[model samples]
Target: MTLPHVHIIGTGLLGTSLGLALRRAEYPVTLSDQSPTAVRLAADMGAGTAAEPSTADIVVVATPPDVAARTIVAALDTWPEATVTDVASVKTAVLAEARTLTGDPVLARYIGCHPMAGREKSGAIAARDDLFLARPWVVCSDEDTPADRLAAVVALAEATGAAVVHLDPEFHDSAVARVSHAPQVLASLMAGRLKDMPADGVALAGQGLRDVTRIAASDPGLWTQILAGNAAEVRAVLADVRADLDALIGALDLEPGALATIAGLFAAGNEGHDRIPGKHGQAPARYSSVTVFIDDTPGALARLFTDVGELGVNVEDIRIDHATGIKLGSVDISVIPSAQVTLTEGLAARGWWVPEAAIDTEGRE
Candidate 1:
């Protein structure tokens, strides 16, 4: 029996990553791009077949917003044997364009998709097979969409270790406008303010600024297309933010204890922030730190955790910086606040070096 072939169009980060994931799972893969270099590189990186997409069972259009709709339309029109999907950020416009381009004939064979995962990186070279792991991959289907198409897309997403979410295309755009696009614009705007400041000014920058503006480093060419495609929804969110900023400025001007009134606004923000899921859908949990030196050997991490468990301390978080081909590892374990001292001493006495046991006191850590 022939293995199912999955074709990925536009072998950029998302496309190549998906291809890498599908290929790793033993599915047959084919990769294509207008750039021969991109196609060659992604294929060399074990992403796909490096052949035309006409013979695949799945076709994923992962191009930029400008061409994503037409790309999807072309896939549906050209590859009726394949279940069609896209990884474009803005779904509403692409879906609308696909509707106009293909009419009702191929709608059921096409599913609108967006994987809510990315890094401040681009191109096939930056693609990682596990990039979509544990991230939300949304599938939007209209009433006319076929169950098999939706299931195929969901299966692809699940094979990449992503959780599948279903939503209407319109709501998906609006929701992302609030959580994704608005943040991108806001980050760009904030980072833009740093241009005139002294170079040393950024040297003094803390993780807070980095956290808020990290997405500012995204590709401007790609973002221009996305913001343009989802202009209405993005503008709506920005408008609401503008109104809040104006109110906040007005509140600052109030005399004396007038500042106290706006405290509720901030407190509300804090509460709402806590309600959002943390890493792996867990609630927001804070941790105290215990820094340890790890031997660069197999099961070193396992031993560290075992030692920590012996101290009756639960590790709430952990980070490891083990450079490739290096013989030493720096591991920071985050435990309950009250257990930091006990765990630190226990690990140190067990011949593990403990440096800073205090909470990092900064950064998202």
Candidate 2:
């Protein structure tokens, strides 16, 4: 069977990545971009041919949020028979703008989607064919949407190995505002503080700071467009954050009830953190950690995991922290609470050096 021809616009990270993934799925794909260099780069990277298509079965607008709406309108007009979709992070405003720009019934062909997958890097150079693997891809379709058109977009999203989720456009915008845009602003703000720090202070940074500031490395030009497009929604989330910040500051200065305020804030954070889904979108469940000391050598980590697997305890998650100024690392292996004691004892019996405190899994239970 002949797969649908999917023509991608913009040829940046998402666009190129989709083109690459679709091509791998045996779909006919053509790519174009405002920058000829970008399209050529994407093609050279095996994404697709850099050319304009007379028509396509589907047209994806992977341009930045600022240009996404007009681009969607253009795609609809250019390919009246094609199903169109945009992967812009902001949805409500983009859909509204497209609705305003076109009076043609082709407007119904335009579907807004946000693939909740990206990296800190940008451009075709950083594009990966598996970028969307197992990531959430939000499809904003309503009762007014045509069944075939929506199905085409969903198929396209699933073709890239993404998990498709249906959501209302307004709700999609509001949700991303709190989860994505606001966090980008906060990361950028926190990262900005490190710029003027003393060299020694900067050198002291560890994985914790890296986790918080990682997205701060994303494109400023693109983020400015995203934050501006979702200003009202982002502002709402930020306002709540500011309120919490002000309350904390006031408590510190006012002295009375200071400790209670701090404790309450931390407790609120813990409650919120637990709401985040675990691996494979499962409900969050408390897992017990078994930290093991391992030599910082190539096969050392693999050997430890092999030993753990032999012990028959499923590994839920893992983290490794290098011991400062030493050629040793501590690997924290998270497993179901029930398996904690067996895994700890099993590893120690195998000479894996399980920490004495970690061996007492009852405390964590």
Error of 2 at 172 (Å): 0.9
In model 1, the worst 10-residue window by lDDT is: 356-365
RMSD of 1: 5.1
* Cα RMSD for candidates in order: 5.1, 2.3
Off by over 4 Å in 2: 200-207, 357-365
The C-alpha lDDT values of all candidates are: 0.84, 0.88
For candidate 2, lDDT tens digit of each residue in 157-263? 99999999999988988998987898889999999999999999998998889989988888898888888888889999999999999999888875878989989
Q: What TM-score against the true fold does each predicted structure earn? A: 0.81, 0.93
Model 1: CA > 4 A from native: 1-3, 199-204, 286-314, 318-333, 336-365
Q: What is the lDDT of candidate 2?
A: 0.88
- In candidate 1, position 189 carries an lDDT of 94
Task: Look at candidate 1 and give me any clashing residue pairs.
Answer: none
